[model samples]
Target chain A: MSEDDAVAGPTDDGQLVRVEGFLVRLDLAYEPDGHLWVAPPDGSTGNVRIGLDPLGVETTGTVAHLVVGSVGTRVRRGEPLGSLEAEKFVGPLVAPLTGVIRAVNPALATPRQVVEDPYGTWVAEVLPEAWEEESAQLVRGADRLPAWFADEVRRFRLEGVLAQ
Target chain B: MGPEALLETPARPGSRGSRRAGRTLGTLRVLDFGAVSPVRSQSLWHALACGVGRGSPAALALCRPAQPYVSLGYHRPLADLDLGTCRRRGLPVLRRLVGGGTVYLDPRQLFFQVVVPPDAVPAARSQAVAELLGPARAAFEAAGLPADFDQGELAVAGRKVCGHGAGLVGGAVVVVGNLLERFDAAAAAGVLWAPDAESRRRLAGRMAECVGPDPTWPVDAQAFAEGLVSAYAEAFGVTPEPGGLTPFEERVARRFDRLLGSPAFLCGPGGQSETQLTERRRAEIWTVKVRAGVVEARVVLDSTVLRAALVGGRLRDVVVEDPEGDQDPGVATALEGVTEGSPALEALARGGPSAARAAAAAARLLARARGGGE
Candidate 1:
């Protein structure tokens, strides 16, 4: 999955509220990490629009191999959605919500797309039954961006990237 | 019962009931991943350790490292290893969470691990020690493999064929052991303590190392692992459900990645260095055997410059030959009862001072031989 796909942007928190199949945030700028995240233009049931908060990309090192589950398979919330093999080690791609796998980006199978166009690469799109419950766990909007990113960075030692 | 089918408990940091409710537990979950080589074994050990540590359910994994290697306790010093020997022999040195002396492992050996909660038994201390050392004896007895535990050493006949160790973390205990099936004795020899080396060589020479050297034992790797899993499951009455790494375990893996990335934890003692080493190295440990009518003397030398000999069953002589060549007259009486034909002779052959050094350069030799170093 792309860096952009790991945590998409928070457009208008209003639109990003809970949807049935998936959640969509149309117009928010900035995440707790200060990265600008946005949703994809496609209006698919499984794929949600996602973009990274600016600082999110800077904190996490360059993307490596992206491991997405078999497309079109059923998944549960918090299941190992897959993994993002970072430059250092394989980082997890946690499931946002329980749903059936609808689609995944073909670019992930090849290592280059992750590095060349991480923002454009879409990981996996799940059509969730409860979007609000899942999105509630994700950080949305500019104010929450920094803290969310900081917590993860501190916990995973993403600060290793910052040091580099 | 394949490796992929092994079930792992919930990994998302939640109660077991919430994640897995009434999943039909298998009678025996055999995770046969063929023979995973050493490099892969390291990773599997990490993954298994992390899984068990986080209550990710019980599992049995079998793998063989591609090359020969030695793994020391977490706090063991790299200096303890003869790096030149390891490199020349194409062996790698690794550090593991388990506490014990260094071990030599290869594909010829079968690695078995038991991941379970500490409460599996009533008495934690005896239970912890028995889990690895005891089960092997039972399994071998059942399979007619001739196994016994001689003072925590899992020996076949009179020679040790298994080296076991355990690591307790986060309320979960992981016991790992290796069955030396058809390994290179010479290569493996370089990894043992000189004391153990002498013991092994004597035992091998007597053909007493293994009571039944069953080269054609019906128990293959998969069958042996499955038997152990089933034996343990039956003994513990746990119906294992096959599972895989949970999402939370992956998160834990991320945490592990961060931890391993730090050289301090991997390299240094992280503050428990001295305590761990001191605890592991016991002094003047005596394993007595009435059958042999001899007290197996294990003297962990703490200081240098003393030519200490286990003549017969006692400290036969202590000669210190330094700038001040001083011979402790008390040593002759200390060696009073020890005889020439005891196991002490074997220890002397392997670790005792040479005749010339025993008489002339006693102090320097004693100093160098302190700590019973390999």
Candidate 2:
């Protein structure tokens, strides 16, 4: 485990302590509107790994299949990098960043397995176009994440998409 | 406002509208609810539905499967089927582009596929099921079948009469389901690659009990399909308009139709070769816990031919290879006297002429029970 994967220490105030409902781990970086999370890339490798956020997994039923574009495929922001099929829905795994796909987890056995270990299963690794500039726009750190995730959960609940 | 909303729901067959109104948004295009081959009825609709998610307005298509075919969901394991038997029977086993469990489709089922933009679908999967399937459920009711979309299963009259699956493609949500006029429960059980006959029987029985289509419901395929059009229009608040497939959709569907027809389509790149089935007969022993003592049976297969029939652990009722008749009672008694993994069972395989072959076949049947470990 790298330093980026470290869990935040408990502060005396408890202002932004961990609360789980549509899990928002403080360790991962998230795209604001999309249901995606990215792991910090080490200096040695330029590829940044990405996976579906908890909310994204919960909103889609049993994932039946995962299909990805070929390596070296350049994807525009919001374009489909691949697709995830669930029992009741089939949706594109939209690109969270404008980048060339560096690698996809070739070992991905079954799409349904994502339900068990979502965070650990990185769908693809990409050479980010401008993550340095884009990271600033993402919802990161313990301070802002709780509110953002809670708001999304509430929106989903009201829309009759998520259970209360 | 969506393209369909700004323009009249049906668009009046090329009637002039505002520059912005030309986009598809409010109206739901209705396709002919006619019977088609399994490809056109199932996978083709899926390919078209996914294509519509990109930019076009939402649409619905309904059809009945013209012939028998086994379809697996995008992620379903092909190991769930007896491929050799399917092949021998001229059954085309297809892995559907959509996401769902494996199913057997024949003329008795009416299939409906719906595609809508991402914005139209709720953000939650559960809500989307309720929202999208609500129209289908209402349609079933209109067809004289009370229905509810539970999880991914559609139950009519408290039993599963329909199986539903959905997915998102190209920024759109696609949901598909069927209205069963009748179901071949035994054949469905036989084709599935399950462990023991008990489980397969349970599956068939439970499916019959919970999900199998009602054979008694007077089926009027065309009339039932028309009911769906009306229900969907009301449920989604769209006007049904007579329309045909767009040029782009036709091209996309045609491309995928050919792709879906390929043999490789049934087995993904990572799929294992017809894993458990060996060339010659492989004897496999399968034991299932029933109300009685542990009921064990041996399914002997020489390639696709069923060499022995020891279903439900009753040797008195012996069926030798695709036959439903009685064999010698003395042979059955000898087979029953020997327990699994015993020396007597091994001796039995080499003992008599015909009976000995069956005895040896039982031991080989053990492999299938353990799950295709060829």
The best candidate in terms of DockQ: 2
Best by lDDT: 2
Q: What is the TM-score of each candidate against the true structure?
A: 0.45, 0.68
Q: How high is the TM-score of chain A in model 2?
A: 0.82
DockQ agreement of candidate 1 with the native complex: 0.01
Residue-by-residue lDDT tens digits, candidate 2, A77-107: 5566775655434445666677888898864
Q: Residue A87 of candidate 1: its Cα lDDT?
A: 21
What tens digits encode model 1's per-residue C-alpha lDDT throughout B93-123?
6665444545567777777766555434211
Candidate 2 has an interface RMSD (Å) of: 12.0
TM-score of 1: 0.45
Error of 2 at B79 (Å): 2.6
Complex DockQ, candidate 2? 0.24
